[model samples]
Target: MSKIQFKAMVVTEINDKQFSREIVSRDVSTLPVGDILINVKYSSLNYKDALSSSGNKGVTKKYPHTPGIDAAGIVVESKNENFYPGDEVLVTGYDLGMNTSGGYGQYIQVPAAWVVKLPCNLSLKETMIYGTAGFTAALSIYKLIKGGVKPADGNILVTGATGGVGSVAVGLLHKLGYAVIAATGKPDAKEKLLKIGAKDIVLRNELDDKSGRMLLKENYAGVIDTVGGNILATAIKSTKYGGIVTCCGNVASPELLTSVYPFILRGITLYGIDSVMCPMDLRIKIWSLLANEWKLHDLEQNVEEVSLEGLNTKINLILQGKLMGRTIVNLDL
Candidate 1:
């Protein structure tokens, strides 16, 4: 194929404290060894990708790298027997966009183990709309349900409710018939949150409890906490006895400051969600559910579609916590 040339968003470190991004030409031959090579059609922005793009050495060890954790496309070539050219597939997490050349490019070469065949009834674009954010939300909900949370139990709380994972979690919980309470710092987004199925809106400040009381009056049956730090600690204390709380992202802060009362006294279950290393069997199962019964009909409602050239703005917005819902990238543009 003469080493197909394509466009990609490249991040290069200008100095120890300065980084730059631009769309540049790249060749397929530059891709690392993998079992499959994908002609990437779509990708989505994420907080981790932003960190990597901005030269967060913790998320990415090197610069002059591509940062896209989520991708969907058709297979162009394969060394693995399970995948064939022309097959539609997607890849998320597993070192992609981190240290690996990711889907911000028009192509990606990933291990066979990291690839998932596109589920029926979902298009490549639609899959990117969900992406890793939706997958994390699904994993949180799945763990909650498996921990014995039910729709009839009580109201469920989704923190950071305007962000990608939080928004998707609210929709999925509402679709499953749970009363969802969305918490956000942006009061202007109340109507948008409600449109996505949040039954009520709570200010993010309300959840940032500073009262040293080890326990608060239990309120929620379960919680999908996307923001860690004091918000997560408050959610743990405020959850009803025996309730389940799933912790995913740390946009608020990674340091969780609280006591063990919520776990010991209230018998609450706290599940830490790790979408990056989720097992393949469970990953496929969750993707199937998302494509079928759990799929959100309005998945594209609040989503913004952008091109590789447009991702720079969205990345800055996400890093500043100014972006809402999802932003999917169309490589063809």
Candidate 2:
């Protein structure tokens, strides 16, 4: 068969420390060798995708790559029995868009193992809306719930609540009947946060404990902290005894400067969430919940849909911490 040609946002190394990204044509054969080939329909941007696009070698050691970590599409070809042509699917984490040609391209070839059959309740566009950010939020909530925290326990604080993961966390927690306190530094986002299901709003400054307290007053029953560093430390310090705190992102800072008091004194349980390399069974379970019981109408609010041509601005916005909610890229556009 003749090689299929597709358009993709390619990031090229300009120097030892600089990179350039542009929309360009690529051959299907250029995709990394894998068992499944997919016609990508939609993809969502994430902090990691911003890093890869901007020459963050840690995320993409190789240059001239596509930098989307999440994709929803239909299989065009499959070498594995588990998938076949015309099957709808989605992919997140697991080295995709890191070292592999990802969903930013109109077509992608990936290991069959990295693909998840699209949840029955969700459409192709809907899956990209959730993307990795929503999945991460769901994963954090899953762990929080499995840790035994419930709505009646007390407030569940969602740090960085206006961003992709945090917004979804707010909506999902609210849908599940939790009293979600959305925290953000953006004073203007209160309306958006409330619309996304936050029962209350907390200023980001409140979560940043400046007094160097090893432990703060017990407040949250549990916390979904998407921004790491001082915020996570503060959340841990303020959690109710035996409360659950899940950490999934480090947008503010990766460092977690904290005293052991939260664990030893308050008996707080901190679960580090890694959506990447999550066990297939748990991954499927989370997606199913997101598709059914955990699904929320509020997640699609404040969402922006863009084509590959429009992704550059979104990337810049995300890198600067100015982007709100989720932005999905339509490859067909």
Candidate 3:
């Protein structure tokens, strides 16, 4: 085999308070030894990547680290019995993008335990388009279905609907024959949200107040929430009896200040979703669903592709909350 040096987006902390990311050269041999090696074709940007790249010790403690949480590519090498060279594979949300080298690079060497055989229904580009954000959205919808939520039960609310997780959730839910009410902070995205299948659109500020009492109007049968803090509490209070609420992000705040009345009186179910450490069995099942019945045809409609050199612009855009849908990073650039 020939030796190769590739470029990767690396984040390093120059001081305890300052951190920055830049595309830098890395040797293939420098990657952490693993059972499988992937020539990463594509990756997706996520809020967590922003956190890790900006020196959030909670997501990453080391410097000079790549921060992509989603990768989809073909296997170049493998030592494990389950995978082989030339097999198309994808790896997301293990330790691949945290402290270990991740998909922001041209390659990633990861344990075979982290690889998921790519489903034939989607291409590598399609997989990263869904990425961690879409996976989390699917998981939330899956949980809602298991909780017996149905299209006719009532309107389903999706908060942060212009974001990756929220946008995908809205698309998936709308495709499943449910009435989706999308809430967004961006006034410009209303037509985009409606075009993706949302039945209604509302400004996020409509739900801004977290001071409402234990229960509200019993409006929605379920809610897919990506913004936490006050918005989460507001969603909880407003859900109908027997409603299910799935929450997965803390872009707002992690705190939950609310009464137990929604759970105790209305029999509401609040599920905490964690995509990073989800069990392998469940992960496999969800991926299978994404490939088959639960597949959203409009998935490609929500993606915006960019080159590695264009990443910093996107990072700032996402932080400013000006970007919508998913931002797919093309590493070949």
Best by lDDT: 1
Error at 127, model 3, angstroms: 0.5
Local accuracy of candidate 3 as per-residue lDDT tens digits, 62-175: 887988989988788778999988888888898878998999999999988889999869889888999999999999999999999999999999999999999999989988
Point out the higher-scoring one by TM-score: 1 or 3.
1
Q: If candidate 3 were superposed on the true structure by all CA atoms, what would the RMSD be?
A: 1.2
User: What local lDDT score does residue 190 receive in model 1, on the 0 to 100 scale?
Assistant: 96
How do the residues 1-333 of candidate 2 rate in per-residue lDDT, one tens digit apiece? 228999999999989977889999989988888899999999999989999999898898988898899999999999999998999999999999999888899998888889999998999899889989999999999999899999999999999998899988999998899999999999999998898788989999989988977889999999999999999999999999999999999999999999888899888899999999999999999999988988786556769999999999999999998999999999999
TM-score of each: 0.99, 0.98, 0.97
lDDT of 1 by residue, 75-166 (tens): 99999999999999999989999999998999999899999999999999999999999999999999999999999999999999999999
lDDT of 3: 0.90
What are the lDDT figures for the candidates, one per model? 0.95, 0.91, 0.90
Which residue runs does candidate 2 get wrong by more than 4 Å? none
Q: What is the lDDT, from 0 to 100, of the residue 60 in candidate 1?
A: 93
Judging by lDDT, tell me the better candidate of 1 and 3.
1
Ranking by lDDT: 1, 2, 3
Better of 2 and 3 by lDDT: 2
